[model samples]
Target chain A: MSRHARDDNVPLNADATSSRDLALEVENLRTVFHTEHEQIHAVDGISFNIRRGETVGLVGESGSGKSVTARSILGLIESPGEIDPASAIRFEGDNITEYTESEYESIRGDGIAMVFQDPLSTLNPVYTVGNQIKEALSLHQDLRGTAATERAIELLEEVGIPDAARRVTEYPHQFSGGMRQRAVIAMALACAPEVLICDEPTTALDVTIQAQIIDLLMDIQAERDLSILFITHDMGVIAEVADRVNVMYAGEIVESAPVEPLFAEPKHPYTRGLLRSIPSTQTSGDRLETIKGEVPTPNEPASSCRFAPRCPKSFEECSEVAPIPTAVGDDPDHDAACLLYPESMTTDEAVAHHRPADDGGEQ
Target chain B: MGRWEYFLKRVLLMVPIVFLGTTVTFLILRVGPIDPAAAIIGPSGDTEAYAAIRDSLGLDQPLWIQYAEFMRDLLTLQLGESWVVVRGQSVWELVGVYGPRTLWLGFWSILIPIFVGLPLGFYAGLNPNTLADYIASFGGIVWRAMPNFWLAVIFVSVLTQSDALFGFSWGDWLVETQIVTPPDLSGLWEPTQFLGALKAILPAALVLGSASMGNEMRIGRTAVLETKNANYVEMAKAKGVPGRLVVWKHMFRNALIPLVPVITGEAFLLLGGSVLVETVFAINGLGYLFFQATINGDVPLVGSLMFLFILLSVGINILQDFLYTVIDPRVGYDGGA
Candidate 1:
C-alpha cells in the first residue's frame, strides 16, 4: 500500500479530521453512467464520513443514487458506469478511489462488506447456508475445513438463527425471509469488516420481521462496534437505528444532521416534505403532504438547485443558482444545501422566509 | 413419491413411448406402397418366387396378425431376420456388429461438444456484448447453418484429396502414420479392435460433433449469460469471493442446470448427424447399416433400427429428467403431483 500524497485542490470540511475515529470518508464521489447520448450522474459529488462504530443513515427514494453510492465505495461499478477521476474515497485515511480491482478485493470483505436487499435472491438457492458463510470465512480468513464450518455455525448462532447446528445445512429456500437475511448478514460479518453497508436490508421483510432484523443489527453493532452505513428509503427505520442522517434527493445529499435535529428541524424543503409525508398517529384522517412534481432525471444538468422545481418554498434565487452546503442553525455540524440556509442567515430567519403568508408565523 | 419410485415411474413411462413409436413406424413401413417382395425380387419377372418369399416371411398374414406378430417379436427380443440385405442374418446380430461403432462415435460426438464448446461458451459469456462475444456468437450461427452432410463432404475433400486444386492428404496421413488404424469392422466386439475402430470413426465424430457443438455452444452461452444476471451471482461477488471462484463455483453449476435438456436433445441430434457422416466417411456404423437396409428394403433390419433409435431417444429423455432432480433441488418428485 503506497501512501500517495493527497491532492491539495480538493476542499476539506471541518468533519474531515485526521482523527483515527473516522472509519471511512467519501469526498466529492461522483458516479456517472455514460450511455450513447448522455451521461447520467448517479451519485453526483456526494460527500460524507462515517466515524468508527457509528451508524450513519443515507435515506432516499429509489434512483436517488443511494445504492450506487454504496456500490461505488466497494469499487463495484464497472464499464458504462464509472467513478470519476476527481472523486476520492478514503478508508481509514488511505485514499482508495484509485485502487485497482485486485487492491479492492483485499479491502472489500476484509475491511468493508455489504448486505443488499432481497435476501431470498441474495442467497444462492443451490448451496447450503453454512457453505455460503464458509466461503466468506475461507476467502478472507485462514480458517478452513472443520474450523471454517464450526465458525460458520457460530456466526449463524450469533445472528439469532434457531437450531444453528441443524439449520446451517438447510438451503436458502428452507429458511424464512428474515432468516435468509440474517444468513446474509452473518456472511458479511465473517471477516469482521470495519464498515458494513446495509442497502435496505429490511425493506423486503414483513413489519414484525423488519423490526427483528433491525434489532438484530443494532445488537450486532453494539457488540462489534461496527461502523454501519445504513441505506434506506424509510425514515422511521433510520430514526430507530441511525445516529446521523443524510437526506438524499436527485443524486446528491440535500441535508445532513444529527438524527434528532434533522427530524425536528429539517432545513431542506425536500427533507421537510419527506418527514411530513409520513402518516403519523397524530395526523389521522388528513391527507398526507407530498412533495409536488417528480424527481428530475439525473441526466439533466443542475444549473440551479436540483430540488427547486419540487420544493414548496422555492424563491426566485432558488432557480438562478445551485446551493452549496452551508452550516445550518447553531450546530455547525448540521449542514444543508438550500438557499434558505445561506451562511449569512440565522435558522429562525431562514424558516421565517420560507413560511408561506397563509401559515401563522408561529416560529 | 420416493426418489427411486419416481425414477422407476419415469423409466416405466418410456415403455409406452417406445411401443407407440415403434408401432407407428411399423405400420407406416408395412402399409406403405413399397413392396418388400417386389423390391427383393427386382423387375426381372419372378412372380412365383416373390409369392414364395412373401409366404415364407409371413408378409401374406393379415394386417392385425402381422402387427400381433411384430409386437410378439418385440416382446421376445426376436426382431426377425434381414430379408433382402444379408438374407439370413438376424437383426440382433447386425446390431451387435454395428452398435459399438455407433456408440463409440456417439460418445465422441457428445464429448467433443462438452469439452470444446462449453469452455468457449463460458469464455464468450463472461464478457458479453464485447468483440469476442460477437465473433463467437456469429461463428456459432454460421457453424449451425452449415448442413452436416455438406460439412462432411467438405471435410473429406479437404482431408483426403491427393490431387488437383488445394490438395491435402490428412486422411492418408492418419492411416499411414498409424495415428488412426483402419478399423477391423468384422471384429469390433474385441476391446483392441473396438479401440482401433474408435480411431477410424474420429473423422466422422468430429464432423457430427461440430454440427451439434454449434447448438450446444449457443445453449451454453445463453445459460451462462442468464446465470450471470442472477441475484445470487451478484451476491457472491459482494461477499468478496474471488472472480474466478464466483464464476466457477456459483455461476457455472447454475448455468449447467438449464443446459441438461439441451445436452440430451443434442445426443439424439448427433445420432441423426451420424447417418450423414457415416455414409460420407464410409464408417461401418448403424447409421450406414440403416441406410443400406433402407436401400435394400430389408424390413426387419429397418424396423429394428428404427425401434432402437426410438428407444434411445426415450432413454435419453428419461435420463435428462432424472438429472434435473439431481442438479437442482428446487425440482423434485416428492409431491407426487
Candidate 2:
C-alpha cells in the first residue's frame, strides 16, 4: 500500500476507525442460513478491521464460520444463506454491504480476491491451469489471447513453479497437491486485489509445502503491500502471519488481540484451551490436553456464554449470563469476550447490548 | 493408447461379440419346436411336399454345413431371402424399405428429448426445490410412467377422430394432412414429403421418446445439482466470472460427464420401445418386420435385423466412450483400462 495506516499518529485505544486508514473494516456482521428445519447463524454479529499492508488472522475450528466470514466479504453467499442488512463491510471507505450483484461482480477479483482450502478441489479439473488463470485475467484486466497466456506463464514462474511454461498447459490433476495450491495463489493475485481472503489456503498441503506456501504469501504481500484476512484453525500459523488475531467460537469472536500479547498472556478460556491443545507443548509420551465437549454451534439464541460448557473456569454466573468483549489488561489493544474481566458486560447488560443482532434477518 | 487407436481396438473387439451373438441366435432359432419345413408346407401337404420344402431351404444339409454356409454368407454381407416375412423377398431389400421408417422415427424421438429434456432439466436443476422444479419433475414422472404401447394407443385414438375446433378438424389435420402411405423415403427431403413422413411417425416417436426424455430431465437435474456446488465452480465465482459463464463454461462439461451414458443408452431404449410402438401404429417399420419374421420363423429376416441392432448398440457405446475422454481429462484413453 502506498498509504499505510499510521496507528502511532492517533491515541492507542480510540473508539472509532477515523485516524487509521483501514483497508477492510467490518462491524456487526451476522450471516445466517434459514433452512427448512431451523435458522443456522453461521457467522453471528462479529467485528474486525484490517489495515493496509498488514495480515489479520480469523482463527476458529471447522464450522466456527471463519470461511463464511471470508465468503461474506466477497458477497459469495447465495440464497438460503444471507448476510444481515444491518452489517457494514466497508472496503477501503465505501460500505460494500449495499453493493448490488453487478457491483459485486466488478468488485470481486478486482478489489478483493480469495484463495480457498483444499487445492485438489479448488481448481477446475477440465481446463489447463493457464486457461483458468487467463479467464480471471480477461474478466477483470481485459487481457486476452497471447497477452493473457504469457502473463499466466509469468505468474506460475513467479510463484516458483519450475517448467511453468509447460505446466501451464496441464490440467489440475496433473499438478501435485503443492503445485496446485501454488497455481491457485497465482490466480488470486492475477487481478491485483487490495485485500486477499485466504481461507485455510495451506491446510491441504504437507508440512514442508505448507511452510513454503506461507513464505510465498508473505513475500507477495511485502512486494505489493497487500492486506490479507487469513482464516485458519492453526494457532501456529496465526502467530507467524497475523499482526492482529480474532479468535472465534460458535459464530462469535470471543477475543481480539495483538498476536504477541494474546499468545503470551491469553485471556479467554477458549483461547487457552486452543493453546494447550497444541501437541508440541506436551512431553513426548504424555497424552495431549483437549477441551472435553464438541465445539458448540449456537443454533438458537444464547443468553449465556457459548464456551461455558467446555470452559475449565466455568462458574454459575458463566452458565447463567452472556459476556461482552472488554479489555483484559492495560495494553488497551487486548480484549476477550469473557465475564472474567472486571469491566466486561455481564448478565442482563451484555444481553441487552447484543439484542439488535438477535433480531437477525427475519424482520 | 491414442484415442483413435482405442476406438479401432473397440471396433475390432465388436467382431467376436457379434459373431457370438449371431451364433447364439442361430442355435436358439434352430432348436425351437416350430420346424421351418412344417411351417411352410402345412399339415395338409404330403410327406413328399415336406421333403421338397426342406430341400429347397437347404435344411436337408448337416447342421455343421448349414452353420458354415450361414457364416460364409454373413461375412460376405449377403443376407438370404426371407422364408416367410415377405415370402421369397431378399432380407436386404426388405430392410431398405422398412429400415428408413424406423430410423426416421428414432431420429425424431431422440432429437425431441435432447431439446426438451436437457433445457428443462437445466432450468429445474438451477432452481432446485422451487415450484418450477416441482412442476417439471412431476410432469416428467407422469410421462415416463406411461408405457409406449399404452401411450401409442391413446395417440392413435386421439388423432384418428376428427374434432371440430374453430371450425377446423384438428384431429384430421394432425393425422391426415401429412400421412404418407407406404413411405416414399426418396422424396422425404422435399418439404411436403418430409412433413408427411414426419407426421406419420409422430405418434410412435412421441411414445418412444417419452421415457428417455423424462430420464434425461431427472438425470440432468441430478447432474447439474452435483456439478453446481463443486469447489471448482465456487472458484470461478470467486474469480469474478459472470453467472452464465460459471454455469456454461465451468459446470456444463463436468455435468456432461455423468449424462453421457444416459444419452448413449437412449438409442437402444428407443429401439426397444419401437417394437411395441410400431406394432400399435402398424407402421411396417423394422420392428413390425421383426415381429412378422419371429412368428413366421423367417430365420434370414430375423438374423439380419438382429445384426443391425447389435451393430447399432455397440456403435453407440463406442461413441459414448470417445465422448467421455473428450469431456473429462481425468479419464485417460488407456485402452479401456
Candidate 3:
C-alpha cells in the first residue's frame, strides 16, 4: 500500500481538481419510503459533508439510515422511496437533489461512484469482471474497444488481482469473495469518480481481507486525492479509515467529531454506550456493556430525543425536549446532541468542566 | 462433468423416458376395450370372420408376446401398417405425409408468441402497476381463458365463411390471391405448397398462438419482475449504466434464464393444441391423423405418434437443461457426480 502511494502523483483529471475543495455537501436530507401501511423515514434530516481528499465515516447500527443516506446522495432511491423536496444534495457546488433520471446518469459514474456490500451479489454473475469494468469506463469515459480493455486490465491489476490479463476473462463466480470485492472496487474506480461512496465495502470480507481492502482504499485515496464517504456499522473500521466520524441513531446524526477526539471523548450517551460496548484488551474476559433498549422504529413520530429511551443518562427533560447540537470541550468542531452541555458554555467553561480530559487520560 | 459430457448424460437419460412412454402407450391402447379386429370385421354377425381377422392380425397372441413383438418392431423402426384407419398405409408413411404440416403449425404458434408476447411482457414488467401493465395482464387472462377449439371455431366461422356475420372475410381474400391454395396432398412437401398451406392455416395459427401467448406473456412478466429486484440489477444501476442498457442487457438477460424451461415446454404445448386447430382448418397434420386413428382404433398409427410426441418432449427438455448452464454462469454441471 505504501509502495503504490508514492508512485502515482499525477492528478486523476482536470475537472476533479478544478472543482471547489468541498466534494459533497448534503444538507437536511430526508428519505422516506411510503409503503401500503405507513411511511418509513429512512433518513431524517441528516446533514454532512465530505471535503476533497478527506475520508468521512458514517457509523450506525443496522436500520439507522446510514445506507439510506449514501443512496440518497447518489440519487439511487426510486419510487415508493423519495427524497423530500426540502432536501439538498450539492455535489461540488451544484444542487442535484432534483436532477432527472437522465441527468443523474451523466453524473453517476463520472462524478460519483459507489462500492456496495456483498460483492458477489453486486456483480452480474454472467459477465466477466474485466467486461464489467470496461462497461463502466465506456459509459463514463467514452473509452471503447481495446483502449477500454487495456484500462480495465490496469484497474484489475491496481486492485491487486494477480495475473489480471488472464483473470479479466473469468466470470465473477470464478473469483473468491475478496477478489470479487476488489473487482467491484476496480469497477467503481474505473471512471475516476471525484467522490466514492463505500457502503460497508468490507462487511462481507474476512477480517484479514477487510484490513487489506481498507489499506488499499487508503493508499488509493492518498494517490488520487479521492473524497470517500465510508459507511459502516463497525466503529473499529471507522477508526481505521475515517479522519472524521459521524455517529447516527434512529435516522439522525447524534454526534460528529474528529476520529481521535470522538473516540477519546464521546459526549452523547448513545455514543458513550457504543464505545463502552467495544471489547478492549484491558477488559478481556469481562462482560461487554450494552445499551438498554433497541433502536426505535423510524416510522414512529419522535416527540423528543430519539435515543432517550435507551440512554442511561436520561433525565426528566431528555424525554420532553429534543437536544440540539452543542459544542463539547474546547474543540468547537466537536459537537454532540445532548442536554448535558449548557447553552452558554464557552470554551473556558467547557474546559473547566473537563469531562473529556478525564476520559482522554484513560485512553 | 464437462459440458459435452453433461450433454451426453442428458441425452442418455432421454432414452429411458422415451422407452417408458412407449411401453405405457402400447399397454394402454392394447388393454383398453377398443378391439381393432372387431372394428375391422364390423357388426355383420360373422364370428368366424372376426376370429380369423383377429388371429391374422396377431391379436390372438398373449399380452407379453404381443408386447415383445411391438418392442421389436419399434427397435427396427418398422411401425406396422395402419389397420381399420387409413388401412394398408404404414404408420411411418402416414407420419411422413402429415408430420411437416403439424411442425409448420407448431413453429408459427411458438414463434408468434415469442415475438409479440415476450416484448409486451417485458414492457409490462418494466412498468408494473401502470395502465399498460394492467391492460397486458387483463388481455393475457382473457386470451388464456378462451379455449383453443372454441377460438378456432369462432375464427373459422367469422373469418373464413363466405357469408360471414361480419360480411367481409380475410379468408376469401387469401384464397383469391393464391396466397392460400387449397390443401394439395401431393405437393405438400414442396416449398410453394408449404407457403400456400401456411397462408391458409394463418387464422388457425393465430388462434392457437394467442392462447399460448397469454401463458408466455405471464411467465415472462413474472420473471422480469422478479429479476428487476435482483442485487446485480441494482448494482448495475449504481455503476451508472444508462437505464436502457440496465433494463435490456442486465435485467432482460437474467430474466430470460428462468424463462428457458417455459419456452421449451411450449413446443409440446403447441403440438397438443394443433389437434383441434388442424381439425378445424381441415389440414392433413399429425394431430388430425392421431385423432382419426384413435376414433378408428388404428393401434399402430396411434402408438407410433404417441411415441414420437414423447421423444420430442424429452428432447426439448434436454435442450432446455443445456441452455440453463449457458444462461447462468453460477450454475455448473462440472461438479456433479
Which candidate has the top score in TM-score?
2
Q: True-contact fraction for model 3?
A: 0.65
What tens-digit string does per-residue lDDT give for candidate 2 at A26-103? 877888899899988888778888888989999988888899999899999999999988787888567898999888
Model 3 clashing residue pairs (backbone): none
Higher-lDDT candidate among 2 and 3?
2
What TM-score number comes out for model 2? 0.92
lDDT of 2 by residue, B1-337 (tens): 5546666777688888888887877787776666888776656889998899889889979998988888788768888888776788988899888888888888989888888988899889999999999999998898889988788888766655535324555436633453323344667768877776777777678789999889999999999999899998988888888888999999888888888898888878545667788777777788888888888877777877787787788778788878876888776433221
User: Worst 10-residue stretch by lDDT in candidate 1 chain B?
Assistant: B174-183
Q: Candidate 1: list runs displaced more than 4 Å.
A: A1-18, A281-286, A343-363, B1-9, B31-55, B59-68, B177-203, B333-337
- Across residues B78-132, which tens digit of lDDT does each residue of candidate 3 receive? 7778886777988888888888777777878888888878888888999999999
Residue B277, model 3, lDDT? 77
Best by DockQ: 2
What does DockQ give for each predicted structure? 0.45, 0.50, 0.49
Q: Summarize candidate 1's per-residue lDDT along B106-166 as a digit string, tens digits.
A: 8888898888787778888888899988888888888778888888888677656544545
Candidate 1 lDDT, A1-363, residue by residue in tens: 101112211233444655577888888788899999999989888778888899999998888999999989998897899998888899967789988887887888879999999997989977889899999999888789999999999999999998899988877877888999999999999977999999999999999999999999999999999999999999999999999899888888888888988888888889888888887723765677777777777995555778888888887767755566656765556888787765476745554443333344212
